[model samples]
Target: KTRPVLDLRPLPKVMADPEQFPKVVTNLLLNANEAIQKKGSLIRVSTSEEGGWAVLSVADDGCGISSAFLERDLFRPFRTTKKQGMGIGLFHSKKIVEAHRGRIEVESEEGKGTVFRVMLPVGDGVREDG
Candidate 1:
């Protein structure tokens, strides 16, 4: 399979913790890559705007998360599908988004794909450069 690709969309200025945001994205991207076991799988990252917020999404074409896992406490610390995983990625990601007054959402199907969307407010008082 090809390496995961990131499609960063143009975005408006927003206040964010520069240090933490990239880590959040990286974690998600890494997780997506790890999920794919064979060639031809794809991971896409994109951005957009909606309702006065900057929306970032990372999508992967791989074995999707189960409905039970999605509905349960999947984001809880130490909860993970991987035997060696600590299950803290989503939990930490949610905390980072919330710290910026944003929200983290997920969409997935059993065999199709999974998408993680992060929405952060865009406006004055936010530092876009960082």
Candidate 2:
């Protein structure tokens, strides 16, 4: 088991539900953890601000998703390769992020790793005092 490295960069505030936003973070981290299949794997969580957006990225040096699966079934509910998975994590995550007017993206390569990025617009509900 490998501890995740966090690079929590300063980010502009976005309009997000305090209660629901943590679920997005938790689900992404949990999904990254479940992807690891061996010892010494690494998971990285990062935050940043880009072009008026607050970005949160979770990356894992674990089993990558197949290109076919990534295209067709990645966000479909109830479609999973894991024996214990119900395949709703990503599906639910997408709904939550989209509800916040944010977007989620992914990049993966077979035998390499995967990276998931969530970007939220940084304007509405943002405090200028900070």
Candidate 3:
């Protein structure tokens, strides 16, 4: 059995709530792990800069999500492919990202793989005015 491995890319410093960031990471990791049914699958985590945002991405070489689900079902509460899942993982992850004025996106092709991207603004604190 091969365990999932993470390949984390470098990232810049961004002002964010520390408490919520781990939740986002954990949710993505869980999703990646669930995609693979066998051992030796890989999960990659990377970060980079995109325009005014700090981009973080998690990729998995496992059973990928369907296009329909990627577009519609991923963020919905209580929607999961797994029989044992509560389905609140991605929902809560999305909420945490948005609360920090960020955006989360996913790319997946059935039988190929999946990639999840989270983008956050770079700043010292949340802007009160906006």
TM-score of each: 0.88, 0.91, 0.86
Estimate every model's Cα lDDT from 0 to 1.
0.83, 0.87, 0.82
Best to worst by TM-score, what's the order? 2, 1, 3
Q: Higher-TM-score candidate among 2 and 3?
A: 2
* Native-to-model Cα distance after best TM-score fit, residue 69 in candidate 1, in Å: 0.8
- How well is each residue in 47-67 modelled by candidate 3, as lDDT tens digits? 787776789898888888888
Q: What is the lDDT of residue 58 in candidate 1?
A: 88
Clashing pairs for model 1 are 1-39, 1-40, 15-126, 15-127
Candidate that would win on TM-score: 2
TM-score of 3: 0.86
Tens digits of per-residue lDDT for model 1, 1-130: 5566877878999888999988888888887787666323899889999878899998888788888998897678888987677899889988998899888999988677789998888986354544
Tell me the tens digit of each residue's lDDT in model 2 across 1-130.
6768999998876899999888989998887888886423899999999877899999998888899999999999999878898999899999999888888999998778899999888979443432
Better of 1 and 2 by lDDT: 2
